[model samples]
Target: MTTQEFWNKVKSPEYKVTQPRLAFADVLVQNQDVMLSAESLYEKTKTIFPKTNLSTIYRNLESLERLNMIYKVTTDDGLNLYKLKCASNEHHHHIICTKCGKVLDIHFCPFDTFSELAGKAGFTITEHRLELYGLCEDCRK
Candidate 1:
């Protein structure tokens, strides 16, 4: 999403987008890959807005997360990584490399067909998160 749209959504009564919120949204928009921890984001922000602190990043990250502008994933090593979300992007799941700790975005939603079958079988599926972990190509090399 564009910065203007993001800011507007945050400006809504329910969101109240502030300076920190704009900073967080701007960073997320730039971070296309490398899902980041709060600390990582703080490090990046320091270069642009040196006055920003880790606490500020942490607060904004959590607040934006609550607003569903981003989502989180806990890596196998127990670190929380975040990524931005948008209307056109589905971001179905990820394929994680256990060896080198890399994450690849997998846009295919395996449940779509299953959900159709489930509907025929009189079942309603609400949601799911499926992650497949293994050695990626570089890791295998």
Candidate 2:
């Protein structure tokens, strides 16, 4: 998302814009292609606003996630990584490069098929997340 678009979302009455928050969002926007952990993001944000604290980064991340402005994924090793949500904002999945931390949107949704199977078991689905992790072409090479 562009800086303007990011600001537009952040303009909600509930959220107050601040320099630390802006720097945090800017870092995510500047590195949209790769998912980053809070620590990694904190390091980058500190470069822009040296006085920023780790707690601030965590708070910003949690707030943005609640606003649905960012995407979060847990790595195989259990590290939580985040990135700015794509422009579509539609229900979707991701195919990520485990080695390089690159993410690509997957437009397909398997919920329909799963729902059918789930119905046989007398269960209903509420929500789901599907992320496929592997080496991207560049990493494979």
Candidate 3:
């Protein structure tokens, strides 16, 4: 999405969309497919807004996550990584490259069969999260 488009969405009643939040969103937009940690994002945002602090970065990130503008992925090492959420309206999952931290969205959802399985087991599903991790094509080489 363009910067203007992002800012328009940020105007929602759910968020205030301050300057620091815009800077944070810009960084994520520029690095769309790469997952970044809070520290890493702070470093990047510092280049744009030198006055911004780590706490501000964390706060903006939390707000963006709450707004569904970004998503979090925990690495195998237990570190949290984040990336811009895809703008599609469809339900999907993601595959992350363990080596390079590159992310690719998988449009097909396995839970499409949830209703069938749930019927057999007589269980009610509330919500779910599914993420796949492996080496990407470039990382495999």
Q: Rate the local accuracy (lDDT) of all candidates.
A: 0.72, 0.87, 0.83
Give the range of the ten consecutive residues with the poorest summed lDDT in model 1.
83-92
Candidate 3 lDDT score relative to the true structure? 0.83
Q: Quote the lDDT for 108 in model 3.
A: 84
TM-score of 3: 0.85
As a whole number from 0 to 100, the lDDT of residue 43 in candidate 2 is 99
Clashes of each: 0, 0, 0
> Model 3: residues >4 Å from true position, as ranges?
none
Worst 10 residues of 2 by lDDT: 9-18
lDDT of candidate 3 over 3-67, digit per residue (tens): 77777766777677678777877888887788889999999998997888999888877887787
lDDT, candidate 3, at 19: 80
The window of 10 residues in a row where model 3 has the poorest summed lDDT is: 9-18
TM-score of every model? 0.70, 0.89, 0.85
lDDT per residue for candidate 2 within 1-141, as digits (tens), equals 887789897787666888887888789989887888899999999999999999989988888888888888987689999899888869988898888789988899978999999989999988888999889999999
